[model samples]
Target: MANIPLEDIQNDVDTIVSEWIDLGLLKRGELFVIGCSTSEVAGERIGTSGNKQIAKELFTSFRKLEEKTGVSLAFQCCEHLNRALVVSEDVLERFRLTEVSAIPVPGAGGSMAAYAFQQMQDAVLVESIQAHAGMDIGDTFIGMHLKPVVVPIRLRQKNIGAAHVTFARTRPKLIGGERAVYSKDQAKSMLCD
Candidate 1:
């Protein structure tokens, strides 16, 4: 069981989300990935324990954030499922992600992923995704899900409960060298062509 109270978890998640938004890491309609270990949050070794209550609290917080930000979430499952993600059908369709067949259970997928799989409407399992921004709680290694050119986004809350957390946001690959301009100037040049 998680020693951390639900309120504390909520507050931590809220702060992380707000900081990411302030840092310009998150935006509306972006795909955000979360890889969590309820066991780690509970102060136990990773994969040794699973806490549904903790998972629920985190999921609720994420739902509130999504409601306010319009950002979609992808919950990464544990290694038993090869770290596949639990995502909504809408996200799957929009990203053209390949769907796999595997219903996540607490032991196999970790509590967070299991909770997400159950709560999401029209949810599906995806083998991989290229998310715009991501948070890895408990060192679940969410890096694989993030897009190329990932930029680490530091947050005020370094850890959520006993779990260590890391965040990152993706950016477009810079194509040109020192003299080349990006963004507005590049767009103007393209228009001129």
Candidate 2:
């Protein structure tokens, strides 16, 4: 895949977020997980073609997305770091983050997530989260980190340059067994009321 322009990247992201909005997958100021592999975006296996330049473009696009949508960004690091997440201190405290340690580097944390680690104002590694929505670009495998009840999202702008992109918005899990009549509104509200 050729290096995509930042503007194009933003457009793709914008299209993605717009669909989430339509689906009630995300709301203003909600937390969203993003796990991107620059190598995959460039049509290579994840971590094989880590590129800081490509990472920067995607990060910029994410930042703009956050600013426009009022959504918090939670970046999932590569498996080298045990898939730890880089989140803001505010989110940490609000979510009662469980302390963890690791410095992300190329091939370990993947370039984009590593870049997030370096760029965070007050970064911390957390074990888990229940994000409202999430993007898994290049098969970063973020399902374990997302909230339960992952629902797939289809966007018109499919591949972000050869790397398949997938999105999810979670809903509450059904606790009781049979005879439990689920509230349609309750399930819908989990994604969007």
Candidate 3:
């Protein structure tokens, strides 16, 4: 396997995250889910070669993102943990999320999650969450954890290291039928009886 410099991983994360932030989708106090596969990021098959070093780099970048945006971070574990999330205790309590029991290791939870579980203060595993926005690294399938009405966000930095990255932000589902007005202008034109 080719060695991937840790700095490369950090740079990719920084660039991708910066692009996402510029999109104006993430908000303060919102939950942001991250699903990553370190093996894939290192140009290997997912789950084949998990690397803690890579996870460390990613965690560092994510921490900066959280500090800058005020968005809470949630790391999704691999299928071995049923894709449960590692989140700060504050977020679990603030959001009233269901707590789960598990200690993530590199082999089971995937590197990114394990690193997050270790580094985050008062980190706890949660059964699930409805994140306001999320980024999927290496096709970890974080859709289930995102809120309803997910909208795909396209970013210039497509891949983080060797991993293909996808981003999304949620919106409230638009209800009502065709007669319902959506925008302020449309509502203004309508006269109530």
Better of 2 and 3 by TM-score: 3
The lDDT leader among the candidates is: 3
C-alpha lDDT values of all predictions: 0.89, 0.79, 0.91
Tens-digit lDDT track of model 2 for 1-193: 4666656665666676666655654668678999888888877777788888777777776876677677788999888888888888888898786868777787788888889888888887787787878899899988987877888877787766657899887788888888565987766777573
TM-score head-to-head 1 vs 3, winner: 3
Error of 2 at 109 (Å): 0.9
Worst 10 residues of 1 by lDDT: 17-26
Which ten-residue region of model 2 has the weakest summed lDDT? 17-26
Residue pairs with colliding backbones in model 3 are none
Candidate 3 per-residue lDDT, tens place, 155-178, comes to 888988899999999999999998
User: Could you give me the TM-score of model 2 versus the true structure?
Assistant: 0.83
In TM-score terms, which candidate is top?
3
Determine the backbone clash count of candidate 2: 0
